[model samples]
Target: MNEKEFKKAIDHYRSLIDKEMANEKVIDGKFVGPKKLTKKDKIDLEDIIHPDRPFLSKDAPEDLDSLYVTTFRVGNLKKPEVLTKAGYGTDVIGGIEFGSNLVKTGLIESVDDIAPFLAKYKIGILDLFREEEVEDGKKLDIRVYECIDCAGMPNIGEPVCYFETGMLIGILSELTGKEVFAEELRCWTSGYSCCQFDVDIKETKKGLDG
Candidate 1:
């Protein structure tokens, strides 16, 4: 990934908060309690939280370059290896786009689905840090694969990736300084899938330097 491009995207998203506030748009704060909601509010929240949307970009990968990096957090190395072995040649349910080789894996339908999954599985955040000897840091690359179930299927207008739901939680944990637990993992028809979970950092490990 291009570091500059990634940073630009982060900055652009950060700017949206101020822009929305200036325009008097109602900004939904992070969901922190069980507040009663109206039917319209529930629907609006679902649309924003679980948008079955796919991003169409001419710059997206082509047929010959369909590989993408899939990231995940397996607290233990053994689990990662086990998952890799289990996922081999497995077909994942998702949508495929016409004339393009991009496959979208449906991982979750909405944030509301996270709690149930978390109730079933144990999730943890993983941090991999290292001391750099040089002023410029080195880049680490990981290979992403399409789920075996959908790898050879014809394009049906959905997005696919090899990423796992837990990895996404790890990313959020690192970003928000909280412990994220999974509730559900669902593959979406929307070119991509997302995981929903509640975060709690009450008694997590801290101050480890790699």
Candidate 2:
């Protein structure tokens, strides 16, 4: 994402506080009492707290490219395997939470609307190019263009969008209520223009108690 888009995202996040707390007002020094929260409000509140870093701060870099470079240095240059695994694992939870919240808040009707949601939130451009039935469930071939993590990166001979892959898996798993797995098949770091993911979701067997 560019500086303008990043700042816009931050602004959108800041705007939520007012929207969610429309009924609340400052009492003397602090906003008093826990106001009755709707499901949407709760979702918004959850989002504000769940992120790794607070978006409320005004102090930030003009561009996020440096941050991206630093992350690459730490994850790829330092301990590649360990950092990649850790990032994927952690971001999975974040994705699940975000997907659940989006649905609950009526932000998007369902998983079919995820591509627009990603673009609206300045995450990436997601395209599900292929899908077919498998014995267990289904497989999806997805592509991500202008990925926030590694869209224009140099060739590192390995995929570096572990977080993005894990997030997609988590989102699909939560939305479909199935076991999801994903493998990064292509990446800009691997001399690709866009990122590609091979995702598989399997259906679970149920007890025939009924």
Q: What is the C-alpha RMSD of each candidate to the true structure, in Å?
A: 16.8, 19.2
Residue-pair clashes per prediction, in order, are 27, 0
In terms of lDDT, the poorest run of 10 residues in model 1 is 94-103
Model 1 C-alpha lDDT per residue in residues 32-88, reported as the tens digit of each score: 111222222111112222221111111345421122211111111233444643552
Give residue 58's error in model 2 in angstroms: 24
Q: Which one is best on TM-score?
A: 2
lDDT of 2 at 35: 31
Q: 78, model 2: CA deviation in Å?
A: 13
Per-residue lDDT for 167-197 in model 2, tens only? 7876777677777888776655554555678
Point to the candidate with the largest lDDT. 2
Candidate 2 minimal-lDDT segment of 10 residues: 41-50
> lDDT of each structure?
0.26, 0.57
